[model samples]
Target: MNGNRSVPSRAERLRASATLHVFYGGIDLMVGSRFVPHLRSLERSQWYSREALLDLQNRKLRALIRHAVDRVPYYERAFHGIGLSAEDIHSVPDLANVPILTRESVQNHFHDLTSDDWRRRHPVVNATSGSTGVPLKYLFDRDCVAMGWACLFRSWEWDGYRMGDRRALIRGTDFASKGTPLHERIRRHVERNLVLSSHAMGPTQALQYARAISEFRPTYVRGHPSALAAVGKAMLSNALALGGVRAVYTTGEQLTARQRMLIEQAFRCPVRDQYGLNDGGALILQCPASDAGLYHIIPERAIVEILRPDGTPASPGEAGEIVSTDLHNYAMPFIRYRTGDLAVMEDQQCSCGREFPTIRRIEGRIISAVKRRDGTRVTGLVLSDAFEQLVLTRQDCVHQYCIVQNADLSIRVLVVAGRGYDDTVTNDIKQTIWSHVGKGIDVGVERVPEIPASRNGKRRYVVSHAA
Candidate 1:
């Protein structure tokens, strides 16, 4: 560490504050948003009691249900079909009476799901990354977008990050594509963000990113775990130092234990993992005061439910599918929306005194399910666990791997070889996969120089064509 590091002057701090205020004020005026207000509310709401939070959710749920019944064709028909009414769903528990909305239903009934008053709400269309092979489009009102930003900013505060803090964003190339709008470029510049592409993160690219980030001196490093791990590996291999980073935040993909270790070691900082879905309106962030694996759900953004296969609620420590309801997005409310992602429930409150509900861990998406020969499906989480075990047991043998399930129920294991990787390691990997997925299913191990990123620049550990 530099003993003579300088601190920002009072004038510099004031200037930064002014710039942040002006930028966000301009944005609010342009979009008629309430981002600042919402952020302030979230800061206070995090400390609310459980009963108070439940009241807030119930109030929001009532409003959302009334709006959906009155305005949305799909929800209106669904409610009426079962002889249900808005009055029936008076609280969070009452949501059980609402039909579960699937991704297929949203895609098939896109128009019907939209609110009749969408134009008045200034609705915007957004889509998921389509990592599962199909992207689902959804609507977001300006307020819903503001709330999303608020939720994100609130969670970031748990890591001691404030607005206008210097941060480096390693994201997909599409995030800052050549065709990006002029305003977005200006926003990135004004926000003091060093944006780097996660696509094609080879040794050269990783080194370049490392050098740029070191020079930039960002306090926060945010990216997908795989991309950050690749950069971290390069940094360690080449003895590159990135000083002044306080915390590394990972999203867009699950953060494996190995990836977290590599990132923390290379950056010399703690790693915080966050999970959110563009379509599901769910925002889950790791609690700074708790263990790394546990996450806190933002109650103001959405209502989250972890349910078993039979639509019953999963108990604490039990794994289940994630179903979410967007409390703010009245433009196109996704009531009881099945997110296709899995997570474990946590019943205990954090020692930090925050009442935000907790999730023990986020399992991978359901779309990454591999079909067995007998028509059974193996989840991505199982495969990920198997790979994690392999990395731990083999030491430096398996650097990176991806599982691709073909249409014929056959599996292809793509491996980026490491120090001790060879025929024996390959066979071991095959057996490991077979142990989870039944035997007699053809599993081929292919050694490759690199596993390419998807179109969205995310390195999916498991891809199932059968899904």
Candidate 2:
């Protein structure tokens, strides 16, 4: 060391050392887990021709079918009951013979659905948030998690996300700076993220979060659409800015046009919405070059089918139920699983030149089922559409609402009042609900200041205490 050079302070040296440690540690984790290879493979696969993509999907489908029928008890019985063999499912269309796997089926046959060879693949157990109604526990292998993240990260790259870019995550986790788990802290530190709890978001907390975003200068923000929109609304009201955020990514809930507009206006960036099921059977992400409201399916990860109520395929532009087959979850293969969400699938290729299929719109989930005295059940989506239509035509009166079914088959409508709301709007909503739900069911409407979101930051339009 030169005698004339000033020595660095101990604190400065320690800070520099810590920063280097985090940087190297992050690199080690990324490389050691084989995520980089998967990312590269997915990036290349996204550019494959539609025919090529379908070919790859068919190959994976065949392998999954063989594995499922041989090792999974549920699929073994299902295939045999239909007098079909694994070889019978030669293509995507042939999967129709296999019975539709409902959420209830997975819940009831959790043990049977899980592969007997789960231990060999390092299976990890996880549960759904139960936001829709009932939570279901399932298993996934480490490779499934890693490859899914790789596919997701590749899509994020389209919106200018790079490794080590500062990110602000506003989701449904505890954001208290104290008592954070070691793994969570390490993730935040190494990935350069700031996690704000969605549960505690209010006007004051939004302002605080906006300030943090400005200071952090995150490259992007990711979270539930409603939570992000709330922050956006608060920021706009408070005249705050999310400094230099290039994009906003929304997931876990439906991204309405109003919410998208609010989020984009507040953040001064584009909003990219994503749709996925907890079962790892489906993933659809918005393409950067495409406009909002259009999501391209990640064909390499899952085979998605938009089927009619009768289980046949829905025509393009016609809304139908979404059934998906996970291509990678060998530990617990969810073949022909019915995701209760509805969507209108687009047959045409995206203008951006990608070969993946696009979904024109996602009509949220079916939500809770409303049961009647005779044991007949009605899906909550019917009541939800009624409220949606009322709000669409009469936004000035009905801001938001939720339908709750009680034990006695009575319906309680919790409403968030808007400007000029009165008895007329209330009566119309009640009548609409009654019309779809049939006669002899008591319907009541009550106004409230606000309707709180579910723990996972989802605003469930329907809740059933009866179920």
How high is each candidate's TM-score? 0.92, 0.82
Q: For candidate 2, lDDT tens digit of each residue in 1-467?
A: 11122454677456644654565445547544445667778989988998899889999999999999999999999889979999999887788888898888889999899898998877778887665457889987777777788788888877655566688998776656445787778878877899888876665777787777777888789998777877787788778766577789998877666677789999998888888865855998888777545789889889999998799999988878889999988889988888877778887677778889999877766446676667766666555655676666764676567788887889999988878688998888878887777768999999998787766557666766775
lDDT score of residue 318 within candidate 1: 80
Model 1: per-residue Cα lDDT at residue 16: 63
Query: Residue 385's C-alpha lDDT in candidate 1?
Result: 77
Q: State the lDDT of candidate 1 residue by residue for 1-467, as single tens digits.
A: 11123565788678766875788877888889988778778888888999999999999999999999999999999999999999999999999999999989988999999999999999889877576567788898878888898788777777766557789999886643566678878878887888888877777888888878878889889999988998898888888887778789999987777888889999988888888876768888887788535788888889999999799999998878999999988888899889888888998887678888999888877768788878777778778777777766775787778899998889999888888777888788889899988897999999888878888788788878874
Specify the highest-TM-score model's number. Answer: 1
Single out the weakest 10-residue window by summed lDDT for candidate 1. 1-10
Error of 2 at 8 (Å): 32
lDDT of 1: 0.84
For candidate 1, give the lDDT of residue 50.
Answer: 93
